[model samples]
Target: MRPFIASPSNARRTRSREGFMTFSPRKTPTTSQAPQGSPMLEWTGERYLPWIKDAAIAYEHLHRYVLAARLAEGKRVLDLASGEGYGANILAAAALSVVGLEIDDAAVQHARKKYKRENLEFVTGSVTSIPLREEHSFDLAVCFEAIEHVEDREKLVSEAKRMLKPDGLLVVSTPNKDVYRHESAGENPFHVRELDFEEFRSLLRQFFKNTGFLGQRIYANSTVWQIGNAHDARIDEFVIARDTAEFEFATNDRRVPLYFIGLASDAALGKFPGSVLIDCSNELLRQIQEALAWRERQSADRAETIASLEKAVAWRQTQLEDSLEAIASLRRVAGELETGNADLTARLRDATHQLGLIHASRGWQLILRLRRIRNKLKALVTFRVPG
Candidate 1:
């Protein structure tokens, strides 16, 4: 899995998780070897980091190792460009001795600490110029997902050839350029030189004469067998017609391969049956369940929002009713004040009329005359006493 950092759209991202591929070896160190909550390395979109938990990438990467392990039993093995060294660890389980050659020093140290076995060793070295002293030492050499990453492709292939014995086999895999370049997410950024099917075959043929090719792709499949026994299996494919919805049987899977695996050796190349890795973890089923749970959560959130809005509207309606009642009370008070003002005006008129009638009857005039006579008498007395 070469790193092609991509920001897929919503639809594409969903599709990526729905499909599944993986190998389940009895003692494979793909995931369990790493410390809890700590992976050896972070996934850079280029190399397969064991703890990534991606079903598709796991199948694409580890299934190739499964094929290699089948051929590696009791043989000296060389794992070139072993990123996290999990593949080397898997090969080590079956081989007499295994050496994991890597370009990054940090990765070598991490692999050495993470995956430990007496037969397994980790060393820092480039694929183009391997650091081992012995020539033609390894019986089997496995390089995967590393060819497209190097500047010197030929030197890398030659180094693998130079390290392998005369009858040794080198199993390598590369992405099909046709499909890889036009992937839905985007082209891989880390790949320097991707090859088409023929180009890859020709490149391997330059080093070894006998070569075998295999096309690899991910597809959803159903498997059933006898409960207590194993038997031969045949593959059948069903596909829908392009023009219509009619179903038909495909004689062969001729679709463009997403990846290709090449088998090369000076001796006659060994043949193996077509291989597929099933995810025993049921990762696809889990993804579907998670999607359904997400939808339920979304629906519950929408319901809660609607209920909050309804409560706000009800509160506003209650406030409007209270305002209307207050306005009616103010109107009643204003009516009472207007009626009291009219009665007061009528009483004041009545008092003014009564005072006028009393003045006309002469009582008020007689009182004023008496007050004037008193004032004149007081003046006469004062004038008589002044001589």
Candidate 2:
């Protein structure tokens, strides 16, 4: 229920600046006095989508309007299965007038009171059996998320074609069966039947010779989803009759779509509407905050780790400095020992050289010869006297 300012992407903007979520009609009917006696209308998201604050239901409602508003410029638009009248109100901002047709009378009353616009009105009618009296008449007809609920889809499409002029355009959207029922065997209580991408395209081709296809409900790496990002896990198909030429309409649809939106006309549609960034939601904002908090925690953990590593490195550096000092001390002692050994070796060599020189001199040799001759003479004289 918070106010949403439209994103700046809109080239021809109207409601973006209003800063309100919805627009309603004048002479508001009393929902407070709705028929307790007459049986209150079914206005839940299950039966008809509402424009409440909950993002789960509100996202598609916003996206569909974003798409419809582009084709509705200055044209009289018929909104089939226009539940709750929010989309119709959105269209009226750009279109000349919008007629929202819902099957439930109670819902019709709610739409009348809830939304007010000069060119917007609501009525109770089924898509299969349109109450309008003319064929090929209106400028554009939009049926979003209504085809699955009806039993006779062919009759419903034919009725929409009947309401549109030969040169007019038809914009429609439906859910992709594959993605919706991928996890469940049980059927959606409101839907009579569902169709996949190929089956739905086949159905469209029967009525309109010229058709173009577009997809919606795209999602990427994040759990949050937005239009114009990722393949539509929930397909939104956009198609136009190949001949819708007043506008050159183009679309970027995934081959496997989650939902489908299309344009049907005798001519090609106009160029794709101006690119806009429409990503405003409570749930998306919540997720973004959570992600930021997680990053902060991670950064704190990294800083703690780096500090611990720095302390360890400093300790190792101190140990290395101590080891270097010890090695220097040992080298000094070894150098002193080498100096003493060199001095002793030189002294020993000098003494041996001095003794050799003394022996080589003549007087030292003569003293040794005289001692040998005197010992020989004494031995001879003692031998002769004894005989």
**Candidate number of the best TM-score:** 1
| Model 1, CA-based lDDT | 0.79
CA error at residue 385 for candidate 2, angstroms: 99
> Model 1 residue 277 lDDT?
71
Reference-based lDDT, each prediction: 0.79, 0.68
RMSD of each: 9.9, 20.5
C-alpha positional error of residue 162 in candidate 1 after TM-score superposition, expressed in Å: 0.3
Local lDDT at 121 for model 2: 88
- Tens digit of per-residue lDDT, candidate 2, span 132-174: 7766668999988877766678888888888888887888888
